[model samples]
Target chain A: MTGRLGFWLAHLFVLAYCGVLLAGFVVQFGADELPCPLCILQRQAMILVMCGPLYIIGRARRGDVTLADYTMGYGMSIVAAVVGAGVAARQILLHIVPPDPGYGSAVLGLHLYTWSFITFCVVLVFCGVSLIFGRELVPRGVRFGWASKVVCGLFLVIVAANLVAVFFELGFHWFLPPDPTRYETFHGLPLLGAAAMSGGAVG
Target chain B: MAILIFAVLLLAGWLTVRGSRRATVLVVWTVALCAVLAVFNHHMAAKLSLNF
Candidate 1:
């Protein structure tokens, strides 16, 4: 996964994953301005995924083309990708077996023949592929970057927990109202600046 | 729009510097980002028009 094809393919997949979720919001909610709890969760996951390549620019800027840089970022990328994939899977399942709404009755709209559901599944699959490569791009012998893993691992676990709690609340109808206040906390964590650089390995 | 241009420039410059496997991915991502932004703006414009 260290060649041109792999790099482009990885980005392509992640980008596509982002696009699908963006579309899902439209298809599921019609022209409404508000997003449900789960919908917001999905959008946050995508923004996280986008941080990967955005960070690449940061790393490349510092000329830190070492194995350690790449290794360090691997864990964060995988976790973000996994979270995205999970959200997508849940949405698709909801479409297939939309029981009693569990809690949130979902934003009622035209089914659109499961297009939103299917797109979610596709994005999740893409995240899975991104994770597979991200988690292992660095060699096993390169133990120098292990601390990055531990630190970011802790960071992701926290984010992952938040993601789960938010989604679970959504599932159980324990959501707050659609307010911009909530969206910024989850969506606008400044993933594009220094953090992205530190998160990603060089190239 | 300005921020997005800066992002793309930074990404493209990064890919150019890396000069290897990283270039394609970064370039593609840059392209994808641009496309996504375009789509988002288009959707926003359409919605604004309908609302007005």
Candidate 2:
């Protein structure tokens, strides 16, 4: 495939993956399943992975995909995926030996954390192998297209929402609960939306 | 920590779209953010004592 095609494919894949992740978040929040600190960490890893493609989309705005661009993007993604896999694996080990009940609902017999581990490992291998053939996907000077704009815009919105979620849960004071069952707010008020109303409020 | 990372991400996004001749800057900023998140993940896992 041409570098252009590869760029489009890679960007689309990242956006689709993030869309699914956003859906997962909706499911979790809709179910009132508050994310733990570890879960938050995993989400951050996902964001990092997303940024690899995001950077490309952004860079592609000015030019075509280059070998250096692919290398850096894939490298960043692979490293992040590896770290994410490690985190997920840690979560898995925590529940496996002790056979703890586990967090969130099970999906197809495996918990979400287990699925995250598998997903991260798969992403890691994919990025690593893709990097080996980076030369094949050469950067050609290209302009920002509508599709690229949409993908970047979507990613931005998701990241912003993630920020809001984290803020609502932990607040500016960094008061993270060991086990969060629900979002902490003043009288169920939205802390993220109205900041001045609750000045000096922490958690 | 989450707040800080997102702030950086928002800045990177801005740079990616707005900064003149900032392709290199954007790439470096993103890679740096990824590294920081990875290290933070390790720290959080260790702090929580997730084991392995």
Top-TM-score structure, candidate number: 2
Which pairs clash in model 2?
Answer: A64-A140, A65-A139, A66-A139
Cα lDDT, all candidates: 0.43, 0.69
Residue A23 error for model 1, in Å?
Answer: 1.9
**Stretches > 4 Å off in candidate 2:** A187-203, B17-52
DockQ, structure candidate 2:
0.38
- lDDT of each residue in A1-203, candidate 1, tens digit only: 35333334434544555445445545434653344433444455454454453343235434443444453334334554555455444444544654533323344543422343454455456545645675444222322144333333333333343344344333323233433233333344566455777878664
lDDT of 1: 0.43
Q: Each candidate's chain B TM-score?
A: 0.51, 0.51
**Docking quality tier of candidate 1?**
incorrect
List model 2 lDDT by residue over A1-203, tens digit each.
Answer: 46676677677767766875786687677777877766777777777777676666667766565677667667767877887787787777667865578877887898878878888887877776677666766545556788777877777778788788878876654545657765565436665457755664764
